[model samples]
Target: MAYKAHKLLEGYEKANSDNLPEVNIIALAHFIAKDSNFISPEISNIKAMRNGRESYGESAIGYVQLKREGHITTVISCVAPEHKVTSNGYKVEIVVDSSKGEITSCKCYSCIAALGGCKHQLALLGWMHRRFEDKTPTEKACYWKKSKLSNVGKTIKFILVKDLGSKSKEKRKNMCKKKNKLSSEIIQKRKPKRKIYKVKSKINVRKDPDGVSFLQEVIAHMDCKLKKGNVKVIPELAKIFLPVDKFDSIDIHSLMKDELCDEVAKSTSNQTDNPLWRRLRYLRITASNLYAVAHCNTVNGSLVDILHGAKLRETSAMARGTRLESQVLQIVSKKQKMIFERCGLLTCPEHPIFGASPDGINENFTVEIKCPTNYKSYFNFIDSSGKIKPQCKAQVQLQMHLSGRKKSLFCVASPEFENNRKVKILPVDYDENYIRAVMVKAEQFWKNTIGKFVLE
Candidate 1:
């Protein structure tokens, strides 16, 4: 159990991300009313950002251009409601913008922030799209894209994190009932038998099958139901079957920023040809910059001010009451074990990992007794704002990628140092480019700078 916390972090990440509903604001607003003019062009952009249109950069504001019609849904529930779904509903407000008089940008704060898609959004959509009746596919959608909800409609908020149907309820009840079946909370060992039966086999097929042989058989037995040819695989794999991304590869000139090359240009003070420190610094800086751009808000042609009330000082308060900021985080994390669903609903996917399990897992997504110092340091570096101190998602991404999971939940121990911690379900999209970049920087530091003398 010494390493129990590690598994807990993984579990926390997995459990938080599980089956929460995602409803598009544009679609939801339209469904509410069309004549309502709250849906903004920026909100529409967010809906189209994830499509096939490739835009590459540290942030979405500069590089991405969304052309297709943006679709946003008010809110949808994974859990099927009994007579009525009470929790899954919201009033999605939108602001439409036209620069040079073209429809663009949509800001959907209420729709995404509060998981709601009740009749409010639908009615709003209806009002916007008055061309049709209060109900219809096209009318509902158009209304959402152009409408604004009434002041009364803006007050609803709901929580629909999972698909809890009648069947699920019964299953949950059965699980609860099974908990009582344990007569005693004790580990019981089986009594030893006097002598084990020994049978001598004449056949010599007992050669121990090593991993390679087992793996060969595993590969041979696997099949894809949809494959018309033996070589066919999922369509997604086929698209990116090309070589690794050139942006972070041997073609360093194309992928890396000029700042990295500038490091190599520096005069070497170390006698050894390799230095790890400089390389690590470069890796950290590049990754952190990208992460910062991703997390900083950009809803209304404005980036959110992260340091609004943050106080910066080298001084550490020695008073017991003030010295307990970190302690509160630990306590809050411990108390939040019961109501993880609430955390999942509030958590943002853009956030970084928290309370990590050190060197536990490799790239495949795992954990162990201990990990390399670099990995542990990465987790410890998180700041009080519930943001990772390194300001990068690389390490967490590596953890999730290694675990073979596409998403995980990250909880920030409350900044207010409260007893209850807030959790966010972060979606980790593994980028081999990032992993390779970090390694390359590590290697360069060891080979060409003062870092060669230090472990770094």
Candidate 2:
């Protein structure tokens, strides 16, 4: 079964490039298995393992394989990052081959199937429809199902778009015979015996503040703007000394990678037109990104590599991408102060003892931003009936508790583009008094969730 894109996206990678995007398959599998909600979670835990590749590399790239009228069709995709305006975030590549009309082989990127597309698939699909679909009679008719039978079901489905003849009838009968034989053999294969392995009880590890002080230090460094990208990652030596390979271990993350991401975005694409504006934007990003990084980094639970890296100016681009990034960020901070004053947003007596930043204030109403690293397919801010979206409400409620505001709003930033940028808002309507009660519960939960960990 070949992967066929709606469009054949071949040779489309001249568009955008990023860093090393290929990920280990086992890591991808383990991530899908571990995450209870299949969503990525930010954590403060640190562990390291020593392992190397023990298997084959990925096979399919650029296109996803899907069921067509009957046979497998590969749908190629072209991705013109959020920066590419020629596309509406996603561009497709569809091509139909001569020998195999609906068949497509993707030569573009890897794993655009389950994740997302890049430029390669876009070119493929475009060439297929525009060039071939018109000139050939066989191209106009998809006899794909007429040639294959019963991959998903026992019955052979015949779709009609053209008149059939003796030649067509013979082809259908022969294909159905091949399908039935294949189906019977498939059915004869015995199901593997299910194993009944005894599950071990989960041990609650005590959280050790002394042991985790390294993590707190790391976060403190992040506050100073450190630790980002693959260059010069801080190592956690404790994991090196400790042996955690007794039980099978796996990392959990759906890695979205692009080897040419930096190249495409930086070299081929448009640079921000204004340097001053870029500086101002970087400043806002640095602050908010640092704040989020700080909160996710709990005390006594982070790593030493991150700790000192955050403090170092030279090693961590995140800590200090350029002196320019820092200067612009400072300007943005001043700009933010001006915006708050102009918009009549609230200014607290001082910054919160906790990590929350106040986003907006009109009269007594306050809104907070909880920037998610990724955005889901649809923005479910409010349902069809106009009720508050549960996810947005929960995020806003967390900010409210931290800000001590009765009511709070949650604003989401677009994840498709640059970091530290956002759009759209969802405000949680709740009384300060009522939310306070909820806040107490939440705070207690945070402290207690790791309460057992403190003992470890």
Candidate 3:
């Protein structure tokens, strides 16, 4: 039999009357809690319930319909808040045996977990339960109206004071023009006018009166006397001043120092084998994991554990890459005729929590070497045609950014190829927009996940 998509049932009367079918609210709660259809982690279940309640409150559930055939009652509704602008929503259908006080069948349409159950299904169940709990005899309000979530995408150009029932523009202008006499008097007294005066000199002096002699006297006063010797000199002055000719002859290169030389001096030395390298990258989101952090949907338990001091065991593939990294770098350097210097943990100055450690870096570009463990993986890298995998691309971009280089070399190596074709080097230019997006995700993860866990 061909599988057909489920559609909503028609001809059922809308559930708007005060008198509605009796539903076991407690049973519904028990189903959500223990039923295999809705089984999930406790935290996920809690989040689902919260989300369902929010959906119900936001009026995401449309007009519910109730139909009866013998002792079985069928309830149908649509959950519409999933999309911001679309009128279409997940259709939820529940079949209950009213005589047995149990839900025999429940399913939701357009949901991946429809056969079992999903948050949307649970939301409809919750909405029905809440409706049943209301003991008032008043007529139930119609829920056929559009959900509030649909309005989320709406744009408001501007808001006026009249829209908020505030004073009008004319009233405001009139109020600004009206001045109290007492207030005006107080303002005048608070600000006093500046007074102008004319003066005449009583004594006459020469235009130039021994200026050089006065300067000499000032300099002489600044001079200090030695305790035991008859020598006068300025305090804290250099003991010996070299002549210009002698200074010129001295080595200026020896005196000039590079400030960053000290900071990155040990950078190339901290590799995976070093304990300091792991410690430095322990709580930081490095370039390699930026893609995962950005595209993560739920609490990434593995990543979270790793962030919380859990050691990541190197896989066979990773070990292979590590072993071949140096060989790949050598091949690349030999072919490209460029000195590729190894780099260690390089952190962003503006965002300290984010870091990167490129395989190699030089004056022109940073390098990232990948040695695939299998031929299939190697071919996949090759098939990319210079536009590498998104994760690898993000890693290269971040490495370039962290190393302060405008370009990067993505090198791929495989043993099966000939020596001349052993390694492939692709040039990748720095992408500011992509880097900014990655930084935003990194910051969110650092603050929300890592920061929260540390606080706990």
Task: Rank by TM-score, highest first.
Answer: 3, 2, 1
| Cα lDDT of model 3 by residue, 1-456, tens digit | 421213325557666644345455656865666676665546467666675573344456665677888778887776764544354577678887654555677788767767666777777777666665555445567645444444334543343323322245886677766656447746765875435221111101101122222112211222222333344222111111111122223232222123332243364354776654565565567888888877765564787665544555454457778877887888899988999887877764345456688898888899998887545467545574656888888899888777679999898886443344577778989999999897777667666665543321
* Candidate scoring better on TM-score of 1 and 3: 3
**Positional deviation of residue 320's Cα in model 1 after best superposition, in angstroms:** 12
Which model, 1 or 2, shows the larger lDDT? 2
Supply every candidate's count of residue pairs whose N, Cα or C atoms clash at under 3 angstroms: 81, 58, 0
TM-score for each candidate, following the candidate numbering: 0.20, 0.29, 0.42
Question: In terms of lDDT, which candidate is strongest?
Answer: 3
Query: Model 2 off-target regions past 4 Å?
Result: 1-54, 57-355, 361-363, 369-380, 407-428, 432-437
Which digits, one per residue and each the tens of the lDDT, describe model 2 over residues 1-456?
453333333432221111111112332334324533222232321110101111100101122222233233333333323222232223333333321222334344433542323233322333232222223233333211211111112242442322221226676789899899778746644545335321111111111222223223222222322234332122221222122344323211111112222222233212233232222221111222332332343533432222211222222212222223323333333544432211111112121112223444433445544333223222345455555555455445544543355654454444332444334545466555643454444333333322222212
Q: Highest TM-score, which number?
A: 3
State model 3's lDDT. 0.60
lDDT head-to-head 1 vs 3, winner:
3
Weakest lDDT window of 10 consecutive positions for candidate 1: 56-65
Candidate 1 residue lDDT tens string, 1-456? 222211222212211111111223443334233423333323463422321111110101110111112332122112111123333323223222211111122332234422333323332222222311222233222111211111112343432333311125787789877675433222221334335222112111211122121111111112222223543222222122222343322221122233332232232222123232222222121222334434434422211111111112221112322344235334433543321111000111111111112222222232111111122222444444646434446555544533344543333322233333332323245666765455444333323321211111
